[model samples]
Target: MTVEVVIFVLMGLTALGGAITVVMARNPVYSGLGLLGTMLSLAVIYVSQLAHFVAAIQVIVYAGAVMTLFLFVIMMIGVDVAEDTAENLPRQRLVVGVLAAAVVGFAVYLGVSQGFDWVPAASGEPVAEATNGTVQAIGERLFSTWVLAFEATALLLTVAAAGAIALAYFRRRRAVRE
Candidate 1:
Protein backbone atom coordinates (compact mmCIF):
# COMPACT_ATOMS: atom_id res chain seq x y z
CA MET A 1 0.00 0.00 0.00
CA THR A 2 1.00 3.59 -0.56
CA VAL A 3 2.33 5.74 2.30
CA GLU A 4 -0.73 7.98 2.16
CA VAL A 5 -3.06 5.00 2.40
CA VAL A 6 -1.02 3.58 5.28
CA ILE A 7 -1.14 6.89 7.17
CA PHE A 8 -4.89 7.19 6.56
CA VAL A 9 -5.54 3.68 7.84
CA LEU A 10 -3.36 4.12 10.94
CA MET A 11 -4.81 7.51 11.88
CA GLY A 12 -8.35 6.27 11.20
CA LEU A 13 -7.80 3.31 13.51
CA THR A 14 -6.25 5.55 16.17
CA ALA A 15 -9.23 7.89 16.02
CA LEU A 16 -11.64 4.96 16.31
CA GLY A 17 -9.73 3.53 19.26
CA GLY A 18 -9.72 6.93 20.96
CA ALA A 19 -13.48 7.25 20.44
CA ILE A 20 -14.00 3.81 21.96
CA THR A 21 -11.78 4.76 24.89
CA VAL A 22 -13.70 7.98 25.39
CA VAL A 23 -16.92 5.99 25.60
CA MET A 24 -15.63 3.10 27.66
CA ALA A 25 -13.27 4.88 30.09
CA ARG A 26 -14.58 5.04 33.64
CA ASN A 27 -12.39 7.98 34.66
CA PRO A 28 -13.14 11.50 33.40
CA VAL A 29 -9.41 12.18 32.97
CA TYR A 30 -9.04 9.08 30.85
CA SER A 31 -12.01 10.15 28.77
CA GLY A 32 -10.49 13.60 28.27
CA LEU A 33 -7.20 12.01 27.23
CA GLY A 34 -9.12 9.78 24.80
CA LEU A 35 -10.77 12.85 23.28
CA LEU A 36 -7.33 14.45 22.92
CA GLY A 37 -6.04 11.36 21.17
CA THR A 38 -9.02 11.44 18.81
CA MET A 39 -8.48 15.12 18.05
CA LEU A 40 -4.77 14.63 17.36
CA SER A 41 -5.45 11.61 15.14
CA LEU A 42 -8.04 13.58 13.18
CA ALA A 43 -5.52 16.42 12.80
CA VAL A 44 -2.97 13.95 11.42
CA ILE A 45 -5.58 12.70 8.95
CA TYR A 46 -6.28 16.27 7.87
CA VAL A 47 -2.56 16.84 7.32
CA SER A 48 -2.34 13.60 5.32
CA GLN A 49 -5.13 14.92 3.08
CA LEU A 50 -3.11 18.12 2.42
CA ALA A 51 -5.45 20.21 4.58
CA HIS A 52 -2.62 21.93 6.44
CA PHE A 53 -4.66 24.90 7.61
CA VAL A 54 -7.46 22.65 8.81
CA ALA A 55 -5.00 20.37 10.56
CA ALA A 56 -3.36 23.32 12.30
CA ILE A 57 -6.72 24.64 13.44
CA GLN A 58 -7.77 21.16 14.58
CA VAL A 59 -4.62 20.79 16.69
CA ILE A 60 -4.50 24.39 17.92
CA VAL A 61 -8.18 24.77 18.74
CA TYR A 62 -9.62 21.37 19.59
CA ALA A 63 -6.57 19.43 20.75
CA GLY A 64 -4.91 22.36 22.49
CA ALA A 65 -7.49 24.76 23.90
CA VAL A 66 -10.58 22.60 24.20
CA MET A 67 -8.76 19.58 25.57
CA THR A 68 -6.93 21.79 28.09
CA LEU A 69 -10.29 23.17 29.20
CA PHE A 70 -11.73 19.67 29.50
CA LEU A 71 -8.83 18.40 31.59
CA PHE A 72 -8.82 21.55 33.75
CA VAL A 73 -12.51 21.19 34.49
CA ILE A 74 -12.10 17.50 35.19
CA MET A 75 -9.28 18.23 37.63
CA MET A 76 -11.09 21.10 39.37
CA ILE A 77 -14.27 19.03 39.83
CA GLY A 78 -12.37 16.09 41.39
CA VAL A 79 -12.57 12.67 39.76
CA ASP A 80 -13.50 10.47 42.69
CA VAL A 81 -16.96 11.86 43.33
CA ALA A 82 -19.80 9.42 43.87
CA GLU A 83 -22.18 8.88 41.01
CA ASP A 84 -25.72 10.20 41.45
CA THR A 85 -28.07 7.74 39.81
CA ALA A 86 -31.29 9.32 40.97
CA GLU A 87 -33.55 10.55 38.20
CA ASN A 88 -34.50 14.11 39.16
CA LEU A 89 -36.50 14.81 36.04
CA PRO A 90 -39.32 12.52 35.01
CA ARG A 91 -38.84 10.69 31.66
CA GLN A 92 -35.68 12.66 30.79
CA ARG A 93 -34.32 9.71 28.80
CA LEU A 94 -37.59 9.40 26.87
CA VAL A 95 -37.58 13.12 26.12
CA VAL A 96 -33.97 12.92 24.89
CA GLY A 97 -34.81 9.87 22.73
CA VAL A 98 -37.78 11.66 21.17
CA LEU A 99 -35.70 14.75 20.45
CA ALA A 100 -32.90 12.62 18.92
CA ALA A 101 -35.38 10.73 16.74
CA ALA A 102 -36.97 13.99 15.58
CA VAL A 103 -33.56 15.41 14.62
CA VAL A 104 -32.68 12.21 12.68
CA GLY A 105 -36.04 12.18 10.94
CA PHE A 106 -35.67 15.84 9.92
CA ALA A 107 -32.15 15.15 8.61
CA VAL A 108 -33.47 12.20 6.55
CA TYR A 109 -36.25 14.34 5.13
CA LEU A 110 -33.80 17.09 4.15
CA GLY A 111 -31.41 14.58 2.58
CA VAL A 112 -34.23 13.04 0.53
CA SER A 113 -35.58 16.42 -0.60
CA GLN A 114 -32.18 17.89 -1.39
CA GLY A 115 -30.77 14.70 -2.93
CA PHE A 116 -28.11 14.65 -0.20
CA ASP A 117 -26.45 17.71 -1.68
CA TRP A 118 -25.79 19.73 1.45
CA VAL A 119 -22.54 21.18 0.05
CA PRO A 120 -22.31 21.51 -3.72
CA ALA A 121 -19.20 20.08 -5.37
CA ALA A 122 -16.38 22.42 -6.33
CA SER A 123 -15.98 23.61 -9.90
CA GLY A 124 -13.82 21.74 -12.44
CA GLU A 125 -11.94 24.85 -13.55
CA PRO A 126 -8.25 24.77 -12.64
CA VAL A 127 -7.06 27.69 -10.56
CA ALA A 128 -4.46 30.12 -11.92
CA GLU A 129 -2.32 29.52 -8.83
CA ALA A 130 -2.76 26.43 -6.71
CA THR A 131 -1.56 26.70 -3.12
CA ASN A 132 0.15 23.77 -1.43
CA GLY A 133 -1.42 24.84 1.90
CA THR A 134 1.96 25.82 3.32
CA VAL A 135 2.14 28.11 6.36
CA GLN A 136 3.70 30.96 4.37
CA ALA A 137 1.04 30.72 1.65
CA ILE A 138 -1.76 30.57 4.20
CA GLY A 139 -0.32 33.51 6.12
CA GLU A 140 -0.04 35.58 2.95
CA ARG A 141 -3.60 34.79 1.94
CA LEU A 142 -4.92 35.47 5.46
CA PHE A 143 -3.20 38.82 5.74
CA SER A 144 -3.86 39.97 2.17
CA THR A 145 -7.30 38.53 1.49
CA TRP A 146 -8.90 37.73 4.85
CA VAL A 147 -7.30 40.28 7.18
CA LEU A 148 -10.54 42.03 8.05
CA ALA A 149 -12.28 38.77 8.96
CA PHE A 150 -9.26 37.64 10.97
CA GLU A 151 -9.11 40.89 12.97
CA ALA A 152 -12.84 40.74 13.54
CA THR A 153 -12.55 37.23 14.96
CA ALA A 154 -9.74 38.38 17.27
CA LEU A 155 -11.86 41.31 18.44
CA LEU A 156 -14.81 39.02 19.07
CA LEU A 157 -12.68 36.63 21.11
CA THR A 158 -11.30 39.51 23.19
CA VAL A 159 -14.78 40.84 23.93
CA ALA A 160 -15.99 37.38 24.87
CA ALA A 161 -13.08 36.91 27.26
CA ALA A 162 -13.71 40.29 28.89
CA GLY A 163 -17.39 39.52 29.30
CA ALA A 164 -16.66 36.15 30.89
CA ILE A 165 -14.18 37.71 33.30
CA ALA A 166 -16.63 40.48 34.25
CA LEU A 167 -19.42 37.99 34.91
CA ALA A 168 -17.18 35.75 36.98
CA TYR A 169 -15.84 38.69 39.00
CA PHE A 170 -19.32 39.95 39.76
CA ARG A 171 -20.56 36.52 40.74
CA ARG A 172 -17.59 35.94 43.02
CA ARG A 173 -17.97 39.37 44.63
CA ARG A 174 -21.62 38.68 45.31
CA ALA A 175 -20.80 35.30 46.80
CA VAL A 176 -18.16 36.87 49.06
CA ARG A 177 -20.60 39.59 50.18
CA GLU A 178 -23.22 36.94 50.98
Candidate 2:
Protein backbone atom coordinates (compact mmCIF):
# COMPACT_ATOMS: atom_id res chain seq x y z
CA MET A 1 0.00 0.00 0.00
CA THR A 2 2.64 2.48 1.13
CA VAL A 3 6.23 3.05 -0.07
CA GLU A 4 7.62 1.71 3.18
CA VAL A 5 5.61 -1.48 2.78
CA VAL A 6 6.81 -1.84 -0.78
CA ILE A 7 10.42 -1.38 0.25
CA PHE A 8 10.04 -3.91 3.02
CA VAL A 9 8.55 -6.42 0.58
CA LEU A 10 11.43 -5.87 -1.81
CA MET A 11 13.91 -6.33 0.98
CA GLY A 12 12.25 -9.60 1.96
CA LEU A 13 12.44 -10.87 -1.61
CA THR A 14 16.07 -9.87 -1.82
CA ALA A 15 16.87 -11.76 1.36
CA LEU A 16 14.99 -14.85 0.22
CA GLY A 17 16.63 -14.94 -3.19
CA GLY A 18 20.05 -14.36 -1.68
CA ALA A 19 19.59 -17.17 0.79
CA ILE A 20 18.44 -19.58 -1.89
CA THR A 21 21.31 -18.60 -4.12
CA VAL A 22 23.76 -19.15 -1.30
CA VAL A 23 22.49 -22.66 -0.75
CA MET A 24 21.75 -23.79 -4.29
CA ALA A 25 24.35 -22.11 -6.45
CA ARG A 26 27.21 -24.30 -7.64
CA ASN A 27 29.65 -21.45 -7.81
CA PRO A 28 31.02 -19.93 -4.63
CA VAL A 29 31.59 -16.61 -6.37
CA TYR A 30 27.92 -16.45 -7.39
CA SER A 31 26.93 -17.20 -3.82
CA GLY A 32 29.09 -14.32 -2.64
CA LEU A 33 27.46 -12.07 -5.21
CA GLY A 34 24.05 -13.08 -3.91
CA LEU A 35 25.12 -12.23 -0.37
CA LEU A 36 26.31 -8.86 -1.58
CA GLY A 37 22.92 -8.26 -3.14
CA THR A 38 21.25 -9.08 0.15
CA MET A 39 23.58 -6.74 2.00
CA LEU A 40 22.87 -3.94 -0.42
CA SER A 41 19.12 -4.45 -0.06
CA LEU A 42 19.50 -4.43 3.72
CA ALA A 43 21.36 -1.13 3.41
CA VAL A 44 18.41 0.25 1.50
CA ILE A 45 16.10 -0.93 4.25
CA TYR A 46 18.25 0.82 6.84
CA VAL A 47 18.12 3.99 4.80
CA SER A 48 14.35 3.73 4.58
CA GLN A 49 14.24 3.45 8.36
CA LEU A 50 16.23 6.68 8.61
CA ALA A 51 19.34 4.92 9.87
CA HIS A 52 21.66 6.69 7.48
CA PHE A 53 24.84 5.96 9.39
CA VAL A 54 24.12 2.27 9.73
CA ALA A 55 23.21 2.05 6.02
CA ALA A 56 26.50 3.70 5.07
CA ILE A 57 28.49 1.38 7.31
CA GLN A 58 26.61 -1.65 5.97
CA VAL A 59 27.42 -0.66 2.39
CA ILE A 60 31.05 0.13 3.06
CA VAL A 61 31.86 -2.59 5.56
CA TYR A 62 29.78 -5.54 4.42
CA ALA A 63 29.06 -4.98 0.74
CA GLY A 64 32.35 -3.31 -0.15
CA ALA A 65 35.13 -4.52 2.14
CA VAL A 66 33.83 -7.80 3.50
CA MET A 67 32.44 -8.94 0.16
CA THR A 68 35.83 -8.25 -1.38
CA LEU A 69 37.39 -10.45 1.28
CA PHE A 70 34.83 -13.18 0.64
CA LEU A 71 35.38 -13.07 -3.13
CA PHE A 72 39.13 -13.23 -2.59
CA VAL A 73 38.81 -16.31 -0.40
CA ILE A 74 36.42 -17.98 -2.82
CA MET A 75 38.70 -17.31 -5.73
CA MET A 76 41.73 -18.56 -3.86
CA ILE A 77 40.06 -21.74 -2.64
CA GLY A 78 38.54 -22.49 -6.05
CA VAL A 79 36.33 -25.38 -5.17
CA ASP A 80 35.24 -27.42 -8.14
CA VAL A 81 31.49 -27.90 -8.28
CA ALA A 82 31.79 -31.37 -9.81
CA GLU A 83 34.20 -32.62 -7.14
CA ASP A 84 32.08 -31.21 -4.27
CA THR A 85 28.82 -33.00 -5.07
CA ALA A 86 28.53 -36.09 -2.89
CA GLU A 87 31.06 -34.93 -0.32
CA ASN A 88 29.05 -31.86 0.58
CA LEU A 89 25.56 -33.40 0.58
CA PRO A 90 25.87 -34.92 4.03
CA ARG A 91 23.32 -35.70 6.72
CA GLN A 92 24.99 -33.22 9.01
CA ARG A 93 24.36 -30.45 6.51
CA LEU A 94 20.66 -31.31 6.40
CA VAL A 95 20.45 -31.39 10.19
CA VAL A 96 22.20 -28.04 10.44
CA GLY A 97 19.85 -26.57 7.86
CA VAL A 98 16.81 -27.80 9.77
CA LEU A 99 18.16 -26.40 13.03
CA ALA A 100 18.88 -23.05 11.46
CA ALA A 101 15.41 -22.93 9.95
CA ALA A 102 13.81 -23.70 13.29
CA VAL A 103 15.75 -20.97 15.01
CA VAL A 104 14.84 -18.39 12.39
CA GLY A 105 11.18 -19.37 12.44
CA PHE A 106 10.98 -19.16 16.21
CA ALA A 107 12.70 -15.78 16.23
CA VAL A 108 10.37 -14.45 13.59
CA TYR A 109 7.31 -15.68 15.45
CA LEU A 110 8.47 -14.10 18.69
CA GLY A 111 9.20 -10.81 17.01
CA VAL A 112 5.90 -10.68 15.18
CA SER A 113 3.88 -11.60 18.23
CA GLN A 114 5.62 -9.26 20.67
CA GLY A 115 7.46 -6.61 18.72
CA PHE A 116 4.62 -5.20 16.63
CA ASP A 117 3.02 -3.67 19.72
CA TRP A 118 5.72 -1.06 19.83
CA VAL A 119 5.32 2.03 17.69
CA PRO A 120 7.74 2.65 14.89
CA ALA A 121 10.41 5.33 15.57
CA ALA A 122 9.16 5.54 19.16
CA SER A 123 11.41 3.02 20.83
CA GLY A 124 13.78 5.47 22.49
CA GLU A 125 13.31 9.16 23.02
CA PRO A 126 16.15 11.13 21.55
CA VAL A 127 18.54 12.06 24.33
CA ALA A 128 20.54 14.72 22.57
CA GLU A 129 19.78 17.65 20.30
CA ALA A 130 22.36 16.29 17.89
CA THR A 131 20.85 14.23 15.10
CA ASN A 132 24.14 12.54 14.38
CA GLY A 133 23.84 8.76 14.41
CA THR A 134 25.68 6.26 16.57
CA VAL A 135 29.12 7.08 15.12
CA GLN A 136 30.02 9.82 17.56
CA ALA A 137 28.72 7.92 20.53
CA ILE A 138 30.42 4.78 19.33
CA GLY A 139 33.71 6.61 18.86
CA GLU A 140 33.53 8.04 22.35
CA ARG A 141 32.72 4.67 23.85
CA LEU A 142 35.43 2.93 21.88
CA PHE A 143 38.09 5.43 22.88
CA SER A 144 37.06 5.35 26.50
CA THR A 145 35.85 1.89 27.37
CA TRP A 146 36.11 -0.38 24.34
CA VAL A 147 39.52 0.52 22.97
CA LEU A 148 40.92 -2.92 23.65
CA ALA A 149 38.07 -4.67 21.84
CA PHE A 150 38.34 -2.26 18.92
CA GLU A 151 42.05 -2.89 18.63
CA ALA A 152 41.42 -6.62 18.88
CA THR A 153 39.12 -6.49 15.87
CA ALA A 154 41.80 -4.70 13.88
CA LEU A 155 44.33 -7.33 14.88
CA LEU A 156 41.96 -10.09 13.87
CA LEU A 157 41.44 -8.52 10.48
CA THR A 158 45.21 -8.23 10.01
CA VAL A 159 45.65 -11.90 10.88
CA ALA A 160 42.92 -12.91 8.45
CA ALA A 161 44.45 -10.91 5.62
CA ALA A 162 47.86 -12.43 6.24
CA GLY A 163 46.36 -15.91 6.32
CA ALA A 164 44.58 -15.36 3.02
CA ILE A 165 47.77 -14.19 1.36
CA ALA A 166 49.67 -17.14 2.76
CA LEU A 167 47.07 -19.60 1.51
CA ALA A 168 47.13 -18.11 -1.97
CA TYR A 169 50.91 -18.13 -2.06
CA PHE A 170 51.06 -21.77 -0.95
CA ARG A 171 48.48 -22.78 -3.51
CA ARG A 172 50.49 -21.12 -6.26
CA ARG A 173 53.69 -22.79 -5.04
CA ARG A 174 52.01 -26.20 -5.02
CA ALA A 175 50.68 -25.62 -8.51
CA VAL A 176 54.15 -24.76 -9.77
CA ARG A 177 55.63 -27.84 -8.15
CA GLU A 178 52.98 -30.08 -9.64
Q: What TM-score quantifies how close candidate 1 is to the native fold?
A: 0.70
Please give the lDDT score for candidate 1.
0.88
> Best candidate per lDDT, number?
1
lDDT of 2 at 110: 83
Which stretches of candidate 1 lie above 4 Å from their native place? 85-132
Per-structure clash totals for the candidates:
0, 0
- Which is the leading candidate under TM-score? 1
Clashing residue pairs in candidate 1, if any? none
For 54-155, candidate 2 gives per-residue lDDT tens digits of 988999999999999998898788756354356655698789889999999998998899886655555455455443455665567778998899889999
Global Cα lDDT for candidate 2? 0.83
For model 2, the superposed segments whose C-alpha errors exceed 4 Å read: 79-82, 87-90, 108-115, 118-178
Per-model C-alpha RMSD: 4.9, 5.5
